[model samples]
Target: MDEEYDVIVLGTGLKECILSGLLSVDGLKVLHMDRNDYYGGESTSLSLVQLWKRFRSNDKPPELLGSSREYNVDMIPKFMMANGTLVRVLIRTGVTKYLNFKAVDGSFVYNNGKIYKVPATDVEALKSTLMGLFEKRRARKFFIYVQDYEDDDPKSHEGLDLNKVTTRDVISKYGLEDNTVDFIGHALALHRDDSYLDEPAIYTVKRMKLYAESLARFQGGSPYIYPLYGLGELPQGFARLSAVYGGTYMLNKPECKVEFDTDGKAYGVTSEGETAKCKKVVCDPSYLPDKVKKVGRVARAICIMSHPIPNTNDSHSVQIILPQKQLGRRSDMYVFCCSYAHNVAPKGKYIAFVSTEAETDHPETELKPGIDLLGPVDETFFDIYDRYEPANHDEHDNCFISTSYDPTTHFESTVQDVISMYKKITGKELDLSVDLSAASAAGEDA
Candidate 1:
């Protein structure tokens, strides 16, 4: 227990495991510990029996739903953007070698009591049914302008500086309808709310470009991808990467407590009356509650069904974003669905999730707009969890705490936390210069 290391990671969640892997690869002696016996701490994929045990207590799942072992339900369901930072991290760390990824099937947005495929590209905008003939031409021109705009090319700026203008200004210049702007901002740009309209247009423009490039990468139905088994495979893969780089791991270690020195800086971790010395500590919010502040609550409904979500072009896996304007809410609601084609369920079963930032006390009522879209759910579970962010700086306390997962069904914000923590710890930004096309090919082959 007296063995000293460079960093002591106190949880095996996706964020912690990723840091463990990256730090170990940098030749830092790392010690990873978890109280649970499993690899993923909070973001684990569970079997049908485990899911029932967590939610239903002694109630057993219906046998007609299929064998318990055939299901892998994710606790926090999210998909990875094909060209997002998370995928770049995987490629840079070579974790892609440990997992296989399949493109998601569809991406849709809800507007005016109906769902429509988001017009992400110029062609899609021209053919979109969400707008009128004249509106479609306007949207197509807007899409072309965005597609051709380049940060370094002055001629492509279209006489407006995105950095100086707000997203609202750009949309207004094109005279796009309110509904067209809704899907482009909320669905394509992946904004959780309409707040981005008041912010700099450059941020939204870059995000939209990322979505288009990601969609073009696979030339598939959507811009996102999911692992073969589930997201639970992610932490395990990074754990293995850490192990290969000489990092030590301990699971089922009870009472794992962070030890602070007299100066209030994290020094080590103690478990079972034995302390492992370290210079710094990295952990999830649960390990050091006092260091984090509750920012919001996320309400989620997990559903089991016999078919794919209706009106999604029969997509076996899909992501649907319900803009707040359409639902008369302050934030967007997300619907994610996956079926046997993704290997997360049995031959004829599907798993779907509806989630959003909880704005009211009644989660069921808040999520009804998305729930109503699902035709028939065989079984469902609803929950609300508090979201937290670090109130203390890691540089001052040497305790790097990861934020709680948000309601969005994507890894963009999650990876931003990780990248931010990495910079704080190492005093440098992570360099991710890997070839994404090659990495995607390798992951597909795996």
Candidate 2:
């Protein structure tokens, strides 16, 4: 008989890519696969690259040594200062080189069609700009809590009671300023789910601290990094690297079923009725805890286009558009207009994304009426295109739209809803289209 392979890897997410790449490079015959057509699980990329050129300045992060020597990982350092505290951003594992992203510093205000920058690094300067709404009054509360909170595991916040709290209650309890509260609320929408107005104050505080900490690690007084190309390039680069290491990559397979042995051990997976054997499988543990746990909640959408919109700022990377709660939509529903990083669009063209969450078991009803989030994507394009004034500004053509609905707590749908919100406001579409499909697997590692 042929020698048994050393390992069989499941999923092509970044962790799988990284692990399989390392193992294969070490001479193990690793077979990597994902139910989806694309790679890079959460950290994936999209194309055609016309989105990032508007706001990005082709800046690079300050050079810094990385902790990972086994892989040639080049990272930049960033510094973050909040509430008079200083923290650094040490290593951004997969950041693009052309797109520049930095923490808001000193004071920046948009007025009279120009950006006004106030130069200061102290608490007073930040108070005038990056002030904390809840922390200012309850600074001691946050600091004391964090010092006592577990700091080892990245997801340890889940263990704390604070995670159960909502963002709204935290703000009301602390009497935080509306401006500060809005800023953080928007940021939370960017990171986690935005379906609830109330959230754990602890998470908000910790996240800010984490961002500040990342920034502090950088040499630049500024606490942000911009990608040289589009943000997708970073993940794409990783995917390319994984392919170079002899790992198998399959996109658009849409895994439909997972098979298990009589002993209750996962043994194989089927995509569109095609079966494949597996000796060892690794997946995000929460995705499938047991043989019986087959379903979950996930939502995603994509909107692409070629035209620029009015009232959009070229310098603003992330844009927020929200209808009042009185507008009848859930308070949780708001539009996020995320700007593309460098090269996200081609010359004279740009693309935007919209992400949202549609409750499982109610996909059709979950999505509302009169809300053509998919087809009328172009209207949003012109709204944002007319807002910015640039010497070389030009409009491009419309592309395509796509969506993904995963029943397994997949976060991509959330990202897609956000991109869709942008399209609603900008009327632009994306260049590529893909969906995420998941399957149950046995004992696995994230």
Candidate 3:
């Protein structure tokens, strides 16, 4: 462990592994270490036995759920937009070779106390049951405007500047109903809360365009995809990439603490009796807890079920969003479901998750609206984790700490955090111009 490098990365989570890999590819000597004897850290997939051990203190899983090893339930379950930034990162780093995925079967949104499939195109939007006959035409126009929008092409802007316009203002121009705006914002834009409405409209337009383009990629049932086993493959894939690029990795390294100099800048990390020197240190919040602060709490319910979520057209894998307005909550609630079809569960079993930015202390009660849609759960586990962001000055300490994962069931925000941290540490924007078509994820229709 006694060595010098350009960067010493702590935590094997996806964010840390990705930074290590990208930096190594950029010709930086990097050393990555983790305290846990695992690859995925907090984002790792857990087998039924492992899940039982963590949540139930060694209680054995029920025999009715099938072989315990058949399950690979993700601790932080989320999906990848087929054309989103995460997939771009995977392809750019050539990490797609180590993973396979399946297209999610459907994308649905909760509207007026019921679930409806999210229209992925203008044509579908016209036939949606959630909109009125007149409202459909208005929405169609809005979708078409988004589809035709080009930041450089003023002709496509319809004389409206989204950069200066608020999302609420942009939607109000079409006279959309409150329910229509809820789904469009929370489901299509994929915002965690209503806060985006007050921000610039350009961001919302781009998100909707990403959804449309991703859905068009395979013309599949939905725009999202999931790994064959679970998200555990993601961190492991990046780890392999880093190693191939000459990055070193150490696992089961106890007390992997960041060591800073008297000038308040990090210089190395200490573990066991050995220390590896570095000019910069990157780690998750857990590695440098004192440098991060809690911003919010995420409440999630992991469920084992015999069937799919109701009203999803019996999708084997699906992502459903319960927008904030629909439930009179301050934040949206997300439901993610996967089955043996994705190889994450037994042949007759399914794995589902209901998560939200927790607004209250009671997780079980806070997630009931989503859980009620899951039909029946053979087994369920409720968890709450605090979300955090860097509190210390990165420039002062040369220590880059990743923000805790948000409650969204997508990788867009997570990738954004990694890219932002990479820019701050390297003083260069991540280059993602690699051709996506050259990289393929072996997949089937979910």
Candidate 4:
């Protein structure tokens, strides 16, 4: 390595990317790298920044821009797709838009397994998607104080309720069908990565309400914003910004070891056989010790891609599915069904995110640990279809499954943990032992 940086960011998570860019934008010589080939640690996308810029530049007059008058409705609409009963309600409430708020027609199959459309712009859909803590108590005082945000008004003091509500309480009080509860609970699990019963519903609601209020304020009407390309856009865009500030963005450069000079500071970062030198290091891939200790487990998701796209249209919709009969205190399974970010599949194909508990307790030394894959917390994945029907496609063959495990939860066993999740979800046999440990060994080569 020829250069020395004033600052070096340990992880390339979007947050770190933002910090790197901000520092670089402030005229600091920064070096940002990930321990993986991928740049975005948790947030990954192929073409996020470009798409976001285009979405932002769009000048089409928004039909409805929430309650705010000065915000741009164009980007907000893209968050919603165009389908679903819940989605329709959101549009009526001025919470959803067409472009920004797309819908995935098949979410929950209830009543007659009928197809249902989820509106992309629907505030309710996003609300249900995010605040799984609302225990059927509509119009609760759920507002948060964001230092002076308008929605922080005491009159809209709904967010304060999160301090008291548990996710379990919200699921029961809302009177949602078991399947719906499971689906929403599954989302909460994915976001928080633990038992829904463990998370405080009020806290979830408060966080959501805070974002929603921010959205309403920024976009004028709806408070939903998706990456122009996909969730991947945020990190990619920040990478671009990092480049402008003299930061180096290296894809596939997995960090093998941190060689500290005689001084305790990290003087060199080894990737494969190469190394880079820097002074200050900001470790941000996984949360630092202080952050992860509070949240003990990791969350894992299996992204399923099937050939022959389904009828759903919305981009930012989520379906929660739980078992009809309670499995212990929670449902049997929790599935978040949605179309992959626009254009993710080759067309005629669809993607859904299946959430389940990670092998958080498993030891890394075990070659292959077994995991019990639970179905959509409800009856079947297609169960939600009874309520809302979706577009048709070919058979359920030609599916690709991808899984992600939070490293903080399964620090030493991150890769193995992900592999175990995949096997449980897809029922396919895998030998990730080579891939897992080899990755660590290969990091030395990086």
lDDT tens per residue, model 3, 57-141? 9689889899988899999899999888998998888888888887888999998778999985789989999888998998999
- Residues 223-338, model 4: lDDT tens digits: 22232234444445556776856777765665545556563445656778877776555554242222222222323333333322233233233443333233331223333333
Off by over 4 Å in 2: 1-7, 10-29, 34-174, 177-182, 188-201, 213-236, 240-259, 268-277, 283-312, 319-341, 359-446
lDDT of 2 by residue, 1-446 (tens): 12233444445543345445444444555555566666555444433221122123343211221111111111110111321111011011121221233322121222222222221222423343234444454533433444345656556454445667775765566565554444444332223334446555565656555434433433333233333333333335445544566655566667534455775554555667666665544443222333123232333223343433233334322222232221233322222222323334333333333323333344334333212322235322111110111111012101111122222111223334434422432345522221101000100000
Ranking by lDDT: 1, 3, 4, 2
Q: What is the C-alpha RMSD of each candidate to the true structure, in Å?
A: 1.1, 16.4, 1.2, 18.3
Clashes of 1: 0
Identify the superior model by lDDT, candidate 3 or candidate 4: 3
User: How many residue pairs in model 3 have overlapping backbones?
Assistant: 0
Predicted candidate 1 versus true structure: per-residue lDDT over 1-446, tens digit per residue: 78999999988999999999999999999999999999898899999999999999999999999989889899988999899999999999999889898999899999888888888999998888999999999999999989998999999998899989999999999999899999999999999888899998999999999999988888888999899889999999999999999999999999899998888998889999999999889999999998999999999999999998888999999999999998888999999998788788999999999999999888889889999999999999989999998899787789999999998999999999999989888888999888988756954632
**Candidate 4 accuracy as lDDT:** 0.37
- Model 2 whole-model lDDT (C-alpha atoms): 0.35
Kindly provide the TM-score of model 3 when superposed on the true structure, using C-alpha atoms: 0.98
2 against 4, candidate with superior lDDT = 4
TM-score of each: 0.98, 0.46, 0.98, 0.46
